[model samples]
Target: MADYLPRAPWTQRDDLHRMVDALGNAPDGTSLARWVGGAVRDGLLGEDAADVDCATPLKPQDVMARLKRAGIRTVPTGIDHGTVTALLPGGKVEITTLRRDVSTDGRRATVEYASEWRDDAARRDFTINALYADPRTLEIYDYFGGLADLAVRRVRFIGDARQRIREDHLRILRYYRFQARFGSALDSEAEEACAELAAMLKGLSRERVAMELLNLLGLPDPSDTLLRMEQRGVLGVVLPEVQRPAIEALPTLIGAERQAGLAPQAIRRMAALLPLSPQVAEGVAARLRLSRAQRDRLACVAGRQADDAANPLALAYRCGTECAQDRLLLCGGDPAPLSDWEIPQLPLKGGEIVQRGIKAGPEVARILRAVEARWISEGFPDRERVLRLLEAELPA
Candidate 1:
């Protein structure tokens, strides 16, 4: 055991103790033990805990009963892996029974429940993630010297890198994401492992690979790791049509954070670097599970590049406030504080045109466009200028 600090909050510690106490009364073959992932690693790294995961000695049914008796709501998030999500006041904890891989098809693992934490730790992906914590004492259980790796900021696979990559090809993308997010330096062994198995990424679903790539790009500094993936031939294999020029421009495009202050928009900026059609860009958004706003913004940015119209009112009306601002920022337009571009509102409507005896056909739309053009050219001053333009275009 290594010396560790109490990085978790008092509430989290109390919750863990409550869980352990409840498990202490569990019947034979229904006990609980803590196990892998973010909860343990983030705690040790002094980062805020997001989700807590555990391993129960109890079988799935038994674990459900015990957690229910303890008044914790249980969700069958993944029963196949003997995992149950126990909902607590502050957050939810994922508790899985100790298991060893019975079989794996390189995409999913078939696990067999065991009572030993060591067995479960051996089956995990990375050393740091394999670390477990004792809720009662707040002491970390390090079966793989994950503490040492954490201290040095190195990311290493639990065992053979190739074997791990072969087990799940998604780990290929995850490796770079981890390196970019937490790991200070990339391990040569890990890099070589990825290079050897880069083509295996083709075996994974495009949706899964696209999600991982989007997540990797969302990181603060993903350029180096992305470049590494590119060198390993993974990029070409996964998104073959994505040109090299855009890939090369990723560093500069994503380096300056956009003003939206959202990760998905940053992702859109990176995607915009690619020479893709609006339809292809929309497809990419759907493939990556990007939110609707992200999809719309990406389409708008792609379309805006081809539009040569400099009319402020036209730009504002089409792009809306948020996207218009984002576009101006990206195009190196003057940042004279957003207040300077107040768009003049149109007082006249299609109803007003009809009242003025203007025919309601394609000509109605044409006249409106003409009126807008004159308004835009006149600096879009006030309502008077707008009305004058409307009158000139739609006179009875």
Candidate 2:
């Protein structure tokens, strides 16, 4: 029992109090209290808290009713699991009733509500995430030695690692992400468990696996973890096309420091390593439920190789400004140097070519391409030079 006052800002403290007050007035004796997750870990690490999740003894319906009484919008985010999302001005808070897993098929779990906080913490994936904090007092309640594991920077599963993985195969990838993000060392039991259950990852849906892999790549040193997963045959089973060549080339493709930024460009750089066909990539993206923009950007990056930078202006023009910038950054190129060259704007249009008696066919496109190439070669001269080139190419 570590007594730490709630160090969250006044606004957050007020919000928590608001929720707790609402929970207190609910029909059931259940009251809202802070539960384990990023809030507790980030509070201890002095990192900015992104989301606050609370646990209440009240059932989902009761929680919703209380929120309605408080004039807060409540969404049934996971009604089956007794989770409701409360929308707030700055951010949203997810409040879930304490639950215990009754049955699980390593994909989804069937849960039953519990009145005790210890039951909820015990059911979580890792110990570091099992520590709960009091919303009003900000006191931490550790049912397991999560605080000890956090202080020692060790990632230990709550119960048996193998059993936990069988409960949810996605935890394997989550374990890697946690290790990479928190800079924690994995215990032998956990490591062995990961290796043993690596093959079970195939049972997970591609979308789920993809989401977890993306999160893993967001870590500081995802490469090492990815390599370990690959060595243990987990990567191949889940993603068969990601071979050693591409994995080895990832470090060179995107430096570790930049990849740690967790930008879309970093994701693209890493995705390029997979030897997936265009159709396969599209399928994978669809299965993973990736946004259209993400799929397109990743496809664009994968289509181009490092040695394809012979025509810098053409590359910039084809890839657009942002993608070009990302590509340069991924390749460790100085973006400042290339920032000055403006994309060559054509002076003449297809209509102008037709007006000049040139056919509106392949030749029109060829003429424009030639003029644009000449403009680029001449270091993108003034509009006057562009006009002159267009005039020369399509003389009236």
Candidate 3:
């Protein structure tokens, strides 16, 4: 396992080495730090682990002071929760002191720092996430059978599933997200607990829920997990007002998206999970805090009609190649038009209509639009040819 550490991206850099070395030594000159969580899990799986988080025995202030003394930049990103971020040349490394839950209310937790590594491991939600590795010696630490669970492709909670969900309701979505990534069979206990607590997801902020849902949608093949979520009634809890037809279309849409070489997008997938309507897209965007661009794209994608976007010239001219390709993919039609469609600029302008002796009013606008339409129908004629066609419509 130690040999695997150096091969991971986090441990191969010198600056990270120096930062880890500095955080390892406490004020008393005793070494008490180890890399924990995803970095360790991904390293053992032979995946690229870039983000590094470490567990230390030092308290938040002590960790900050030690890094400050070493001339390293530090930020108290989650100081009350016993975590600080050190800015290194390679990237930011989050260092968290060992902690046990003092109290939890399903939405948040009050944490008390702990000195024991086992206690720290126990508080984490999942077994695979609690595994730790010593940075210097490269020793794997598994206090909760995480290595075994990882080997079998199981995603089980560290302790009782219900208790973990009670600590943070977001774990409900996380269960599915992790299942989409690393799970082969559902842990019956975890699945039951999630089904029971699916309603508690309402207490979580929409932004947080949106983030998790987006992440789950990003997986290479989330069709199985989504199908399970639908069957389990968990998908309805998050999107109560969604259209059933859209949900029914997901499996086919996902297959088409993959075949069309399109990367999974949350809004695009979410749009598929609702009735194809601009009104519904706007409502979902408002609820999820999606940015303006995301909201606009969702509206456009949902409003698209397959037959209308089938023509390469019209589709590319109006919606661009990307939108046209996405629409074709959603409608389960040929997407070849997007590869060859080239939009032509309109040859006539309002000023040019005014130059043609048309009055500077709504009539000038109308004339220009008429000429432009004719030009489009004529396969986009040149400026001179368009002006010649406009002669009849000019002032007469």
| Candidate 1 Cα outliers beyond 4 Å, as residue runs | 10-13, 25-31, 258-266, 279-294, 306-316, 321-326, 334-346, 374-385
- The clash numbers for all candidates, in the given order, read 0, 0, 0
| Best-fitting candidate, scored by TM-score | 3
Compare candidates 1 and 3 on TM-score and give the better one.
3
Q: What is the lDDT of residue 85 in candidate 2?
A: 94
Using lDDT, rank the candidates from best to worst: 3, 2, 1
- What's the C-alpha lDDT at position 12 in model 3? 68
Clashes of 1: 0
Task: List the pairs of residues colliding in candidate 1.
Answer: none
Model 3 bad stretches (over 4 Å): 1-6, 26-31, 243-245, 320-322, 334-347, 374-396
Arranged by TM-score, best first: 3, 2, 1
What are the per-residue Cα lDDT tens digits for candidate 2 across 1-396?
A: 355634757325566677678777335433366655888887777777787788877889988998899988989998977989999775788899999989999999999999888998888999889878766567788877888788878889998899999999989888887887775566889888988888888788878887887877655456677777788777777767678777776666556335434343545645655654556666656767788986776666555557535555666777765556556655555455346777656665777767878888998898888888888777677888877898888745
